[model samples]
Target: MMPLRTIANRVECEIEIKKSRFVGVVDRAATEADARAVIAAARMSDPAAGHHCSAFIVDSSAGDPLADPKQQRIERSHDDGEPSGTAGMPMLEVLRGHHTTNVVAVVSRYFGGTKLGTGGLARAYGSAVSEALVHARFLTRQRREIMTLELDHAEVGRVESELRRHAVLVLGTSYAARAVLTVSAVDADSTAALVASLTAGRVTPVRSGHMYAEIPD
Candidate 1:
């Protein structure tokens, strides 16, 4: 299978002014729509802000021809009454500068009453976005296939322990005549290894298919 796409867990950046404050939020998004939704939500938090300009980059899953090979992405800036290019372009540059992908960044500004002019606005916006990014916490994602393991009561403990040792996620368990375990592992190799080791070459797992989750930091 192809490599999994990249994503961000969280990122923070802030900009300071002699008077006003502008904050930027960087977050991972799965789709174009998801990215826009995050931007909208960010704006709602500070509806009174003078401007909320943002940028985003989203790459499609493997084999998605429509996805831009370059990085499915978007960058939009709202002047929020500020002169055009003064707010959005700088924010876009910051996102691009950081090589951020599958992510969206929104910078909200509350005017300080003093005009910073074009250069000042650009610097302020970029600086604020950078600060927010500095504060971000992030996790890389991995692709995995999910499987449900059914084992007899006598074998459940052995299976669970082995899976744990291999870093498999036992999402949940159901106890009936047999123990049903929801297992998630990074790849088919890992899954097969765990099953072979846990079942002692007796039982085989039923794979559910591919899914994704953040690799623990």
Candidate 2:
């Protein structure tokens, strides 16, 4: 699967329309429980807010909260107390258009004694999320196989430099009787080959596991 895009940190944006205040919060959430937790935090931050609408999309490659393997993606939206289809649906559409995954958005409304009609509410909610996203930092998430290589301390600096020259991502290194280096790569075999060549067939890498890593977007 191709790498997915998500926010690097939580962000909030606010807008006022017809005296009604709308505040939007955006964050990365890998599961339904995480999304709910984010919503709860947003509500706690603004206890006096009238409505808290929410939307989210989870990638299937990550653990599926719904436990449906057939569904590669999960999506949900809530209108809160706003008119039907006005608050949540538009916010969800913005996420879809951006091709974002593992993301959740919540819009909190503080009534200002004036009511916006359904159309106005939808635009306001959508705009709130859109503006928040504009200020958010994005990251690309991809699955990579992790490998560990053990070598004599003498070979550590040379091997590490060669690995960087080949664009290998070095996660960390530990100094022990033998130096142990942890790395991640898109292709394990290719990474092993590179390491072997760099060490002149004196070192080999063992597969540890797989995990997702964030890359600059």
Candidate 3:
């Protein structure tokens, strides 16, 4: 699967444009419902603000087996009483230009007895979100195949060390009469090959499913 970029954590920034205060809040939103929740949270953050504009892009293929993982991107924008295309469109454009996905941005506007015309409002709102994103941390995520390897306790340490040396991400490990390890790899074939080589054909790995794993931005 293709790598996706999103905010590492929630971030907020405030900007003053022509005496009007614009507060921008950005967060990772993996679905439409998540985006709405973030919007609601933004509204609650500044109840007195006159306008709350929002934009989001979510991966529509998530949890869907037949969907085109990378091509199925969902985008939404809301002006929230600002001029038709002023607030939300520009915010959405900024996100698209940055190649960010599964994220939402909301800009709350508090009028300060001054009006920024259509163009001014667009620039202000867009800039507010852009500035917030600039200061925010980001993460890259990709779909990985999950597998479990069960082996004798004596082999656990050596196999795990070798897997780590090969850059495989070991999710967790459990102990019983044997050691059961949960790991994730970019593909199932690579995981099988690694397990076979590590155990010299004495152990077989079981495939579980796919999960989104975070990687460095």
Clashes of each: 10, 0, 0
Q: Write the per-residue lDDT of candidate 1 for residues 1-217, one digit (tens) a residue.
A: 3333343456665666867778778787766787889889988888988778777666555324333435444445555567888877787787677655577778888877777878988888878777777766554445667888888888888888888887887878899988888888877676776687767877787887755565533
TM-scores of all candidate predictions against the true structure? 0.65, 0.77, 0.80
lDDT of 2 at 5: 72
Query: How many angstroms is residue 193 displaced in model 3 relative to the true structure, after the best TM-score fit?
Result: 4.0
Best to worst by TM-score, what's the order?
3, 2, 1
Tens-digit lDDT string for candidate 3 (59-136): 886635333336778999999999899999999999888778888999999999988899999999999999999887
Off by over 4 Å in 2: 58-74, 112-115, 150-153, 172-180, 187-190, 202-209
- Candidate 2 C-alpha lDDT tens digits along 15-108: 9998889999999887778888999998899899999999999765566322332247789999998888998999999987777788999999
State in Å the error of residue 174, model 3. Answer: 5.9
**Local lDDT at 165 for model 3:** 80
Clash pairs, model 3 backbone: none
Clash number for model 3? 0
What does the lDDT read for residue 21 in candidate 1? 76
Give the number of colliding residue pairs in candidate 1: 10
- The runs of at least 3 residues in candidate 1 whose Cα sits more than 4 Å from the true structure, single-residue gaps closed, are 1-21, 25-49, 56-77, 92-104, 110-120, 175-177
Q: In model 1, how large is the Cα lDDT of residue 80? A: 59
Model 2 shows how many backbone clashes? 0
